[model samples]
Target: MPKIVRHGTRVGGDALSIRIVAPPERRASRGSVFVPPLIGGSGMQQVGYFRELNRRGYRLVTFDYRGHGKSGGRFFVRNTIEDARAVLEELRGEFAGEPLFGVADCFGCIPLLCAAAERPEAFRALALFNPIPSLQHVAGPREVLANYFLPRDGSGARRLALRNPFDLRGMLYATNQRLFPGVDKSRDHFGILRYTRARTWLATWEYLSSRPLAGVVSAVPALVCFGRSDRLLGLEDPAAEERYRALWLRHLPRCEVRVLADVDHYWTGTQARASVAAADFFERGGAVANALPGSTLAPRARYRDPGEAPGRKNQLGGWSRSSGLKRASGR
Candidate 1:
């Protein structure tokens, strides 16, 4: 595989660092782009995603945002969007073929959506997983039932952050130690990512109340994946669901929403399924305005439930693990 190139540039009064993993051998066709999570700096290089993607004809690009990894400025609202613009500008300058769309997880969605809003033409598609959505909505609920179910007490936001001081760190010291043991953090990551509890709380709040998402993006193809189990508990109330519906209806009416069973927020046990959905959306040439279902735009021609196949192991006949092209079955 070709080695990833490291470089730094100044953007919006901040110094940013990024690692661009070029294909070892150039391909005749353009490959998909992979944008990683900002919370965990275990970027493409460290995750071995670059290597796998390299062989698969993808040119994986990973970068450290100003605050999270090895970049210069302090992390704050709007900066994520600015950083994304910087990366896209750089990639646009270097890559020749079609602009690549990407996949982002958790808080990563804030910047991705922000960037998409700014330059929908620059991307081919987007697949977001368990996004932070509206930080304000996630942090605090507006309804009595929502407040009752998704309490912001000790067990909610504060509890998760307090569980580990470095829980929100981009460097991922804990994930490295816990998952890979003797993993390399410095060579693979950059920046002081140990976000303080206060910073975490404030950042989440800001992400929710940040700039508008509707006018920013056009009718670009998008896929949203959220684990069935990771339901934003705040939406327990029907009214809350309406609020969410309004949010998406406003910004991404063309996007397809997929809820994977047994998949946690991280899709830990079902990464394969999430991966398939993402790749399949792109391979199927993506859609606009409820073409693939799950949209509020169309309901009658919606996709069928998996079990409706009567009884079969490969009910969906989705892309097989062997040939990652896509699940062979269709809606």
Candidate 2:
């Protein structure tokens, strides 16, 4: 087992907890930093996947945002972009001359993109999973208003009951679901409400709704992956993948898009597949620069089980196919 090192970095008076996994042998020529999702998401949860990448001869680094996991200070949506920038700067210094890659999940993609935009030369490539291109596409007015009205600080239960009584019942139901063992264990529904200050949640909603992705260009090779069955992000819509693909292409001109079969918002049972795909992309140098963006809804060869016949429906109800990466037709 490779020794896992824990460290801390100061970012504007906040102490961010970071973990680094080094390869078992000599230092690696490549390194990747992972940016975790907001709310209940923590870098600690990704240690297993990072260890796998480390075993593949790549240095892996992941950290928790302030006020989340082992980090110190209150969580603020606006501070996330700087947090990402600081971490990336550290990685660039440590991995000098080595190709650096980035991987972000869900809302985490927002800050990563922003930081990458500010320093496009810092990364050779990027991979985003279940990215939220825009909050308007996923949230409704009622959800926005509820978060906006929440009190800044207090007992979460009492605050919801007092400030937004209408939402209290739904909050109770979600809390029950979170507390019930083995019930929707793959998802996080109440973490923001239960753990964060309500003001932070509202700020996050506002920041995302403002279309922060607009006009932000990173110009780095990027691979964007989405789950075909992502109910949380409503990716089940046949056109949703294309919509996100188009948005990412606008920011990352050299981009690739793939839809994973049976994957969910949290990746769930298909995490290994996702990890392998990401590792392969990084290994390939994130696709040659200047190549037109490739798009495919078909599963990669590694995604298929050995001896699985082509055209047969897998357990996920998606057909298995053998194919190499190819340019998606019709734009």
Candidate 3:
């Protein structure tokens, strides 16, 4: 096993905790950065996928977002973009001539996309797992209930006690979801609550929902993976699946996509399979250059205006005046 070096850096007023797993013998020719999920910790790299990359000759860099782990600061939705950009910029200087790649999961994908939009040349490619394109893409009764009861901040407990008074549905759902078979148990629940704040959670949700992904366009080669069994992403619903593929394709035209069987939002039973696919994709130059042996590109779809409905937000969060591709120049 390669040794991991611990370090800290300041991004704006916040201190970020970062970890780097250097390739054995320092023979690395490529570098990869990991962007953790909303409730993720730096410990996520222990999942073995990152180690696999290290063994395969790719230097691995993973970090806890400000306010999330050993890092010091309050978490906010918008600052995450700056956080990602700062990390990438630092790595670009360190890696120098080597190609740098990005791997993000869940909410992390949002910041990764925004960062890549700003510095398209900084990344050779990107790999996203079960990315949340919009709250509408993952919102459902279960999700609403989960967020209501377990707000990222600890105040959810107090608010639930005062607002609903007697209803324990949120609490019940939060508890039972973890006990479900195949849920990944490695994550630290207590640590996540200690750092997360309710104000930041709400702000993050509002920011993501209000501004659709249409405005952020990057020509960066990308590999997007979805879990067929991911209830949070509503992949069980054909309409939801189609809508997600269409949204991703619009922003990243040079991309390859996959829907893996038996995988869940947390990558439950299929972490190895997902990890292998990502590592292989990265090794093969991270571009779609024709469909890899087993994978197939999603069928092309026509883009349409996101017209509003009478009662609820459209899948793309209704049409925004800023809802269109603003491709990066000189890519």
> What overall lDDT goes with each candidate model?
0.52, 0.59, 0.57
RMSD of 1: 10.4
lDDT of 3 by residue, 229-298 (tens): 6666665566877787777887788888786655556554345555577678887887685754265334
Model 1: how far is 148 from its true place, Å? 17
lDDT of 2 by residue, 1-331 (tens): 5666887688998887777767677655366555444444455444443344666777777676666656777666666776777777777776678777777766778888887788888888888877776655555555545444543344554244344445533443333332222221222233322233325346545645567677898888888887665655655455865676677778877877776665665465455566677788888988844533343444522232221211111111111111101111110
When summed lDDT is taken over every stretch of 10 residues in candidate 1, the lowest stretch is 309-318
The CA lDDT at 221 in model 2 is 82
Q: Best to worst by lDDT, what's the order?
A: 2, 3, 1
Clash count (model 1, backbone only): 9
* Number of the predicted model whose lDDT against the real structure is largest: 2
Residue pairs in clash, model 3:
153-198
- Identify the runs in model 3 with alpha carbons over 4 angstroms from their true place: 26-28, 34-37, 43-49, 140-162, 165-214, 289-331
Q: Quantify how close model 2 is to the true structure by its C-alpha RMSD in Å.
A: 11.0
* Model 2 score (lDDT): 0.59
Colliding residue pairs in candidate 1: 69-190, 69-191, 70-190, 70-191, 117-216, 117-217, 318-327, 319-326, 319-327
